[model samples]
Structure formats: structure tokens, C-alpha cells
Target: MASLCLTCVSEGTSLEEQVRRIKDIEAIESDSFVPQAFKSSRDDTKSAVVQVKQESEKGPSQDISLPMSIVYDDSGTLAHPSLFVDKETAEELWLNRLISLRQERLMGSPVT
Candidate 1:
């Protein structure tokens, strides 16, 4: 079994909203947060845990090779504070399928 562990980061008006967006993604198997689990060195931003599962023929697996922590920041914090995962880890776990799905979703709609 092979799974992909991702640290989805986002900046929004509400931390809960950002988390909700992550949860809304169909690919995410499960997610949770550890109270004050992360403190950003750049600012007062905080991070939490949100475990995502990728199902494969073998079964479910989580790529623990990288840190799995989701960071949430204020909406004005960054230009495009969107969810992200480690490139190396994604490649290792064959998580490109998820990315492709996301691209397909975005492509179906007109770009603003």
C-alpha cells in the first residue's frame, strides 16, 4: 500500500474555513489537528495536522518521509496561499493522480 502525506497550507479569513476546504476535497481520507502543534518562524502563523490518505491496489499508505503539518495564515499573508505538498514526497508516493484530478476540475470551469 502506498499513501501520500501532505501538508496543505492556505491563507483565508477563517482558519476553520481553510480546514473545511481541505476536508471538502474527495481525495482526503482523514484529517485532524493538534492544538498549537506548529508555530511559524516567519510570523505568528500556526500550523496543525491534517492526515490525507491515498488508496492504491496494495492498500492505504502515508508517506512519512516528510513533515505532515498544515499551515493556515491570514488572507493577506501571501499572494496565493493555497494547499501544497512536498514535490519529492508526492513523486515518491505517486500522488500525481490527485494533482491531475484537481487540474481537470479547474479546467472544466472558466478561469477568472
Candidate 2:
């Protein structure tokens, strides 16, 4: 599902490798001392630590090996969470959920 969105996104990007490419970027609106001197580094380290935790917890991403496809069914919405019609669209749908969970966990709720 998450693996199927790279073709239109980046040329020559095989579906199998789309998700493996991750770019971490952060934009801070403040040029203040706390952001540049302290909080920024703190947040970055925390993010790396969380990523490590995620890797250790999930172990292997073997599920990504499955062949992923997004068939465009002519539905009214064009994509449905329960339906696999649009794989890229479905990925967008699901990643938002993961982001929500991750953010919640970051706020100290702790999610698995």
C-alpha cells in the first residue's frame, strides 16, 4: 500500500523502493536563541531516538516486500480506506493516521 506511490512521484523509482527513501526536514519559523541554540538540537535528537525505537520495536519491514499496486476503480471518491483502488491515495490516507498516532505518542501518551 505505502510502496505503490513512487512512480508518478519520482521517475525510475520502482514501487518496491518508494517508501525506503525518507527525507527528514524541519523548518523553524523562529530565528531566536532557544530554537537555534537548544530546542532544535533537542528535537532532532529526540526524533532520531524515536526512529531508533520504532526500528527496534518493529524489527523488520518485511511486509514492504509484497508487490504493491493501486488500481483506480471509478468510485465517486476515487479512493476508500477499506478499498485498495488507489494505492498512493490509500497511502496518504493511512500515513496521516500514523502521523496522528506518532504525534500523540510524542505528547507522552506512548503508542505501540
Give candidates' CA RMSD values in order: 21.9, 25.0
Q: Can you list the residue pairs that collide in candidate 1?
A: 3-61
Pairs of residues clashing in candidate 2: none
| Cα lDDT tens digits for candidate 1, 1-112 | 1222233333323556555665555334435532455664756344544556656788777543333554555567555533355678757556667667678778895432
Predicted candidate 2 versus true structure: per-residue lDDT over 9-102, tens digit per residue: 7687654355454311112323432443434332232221112212346575333232233334445675565775578987897899999998
Candidate with best lDDT: 1
Query: At residue 53, what lDDT does model 1 achieve?
Result: 68
TM-score list, all predictions: 0.17, 0.25
Cα lDDT computed for each candidate against the true fold: 0.53, 0.51
What TM-score does candidate 2 reach? 0.25
Error of 1 at 82 (Å): 27
Q: Positional deviation of 38 in candidate 1, in angstroms?
A: 23
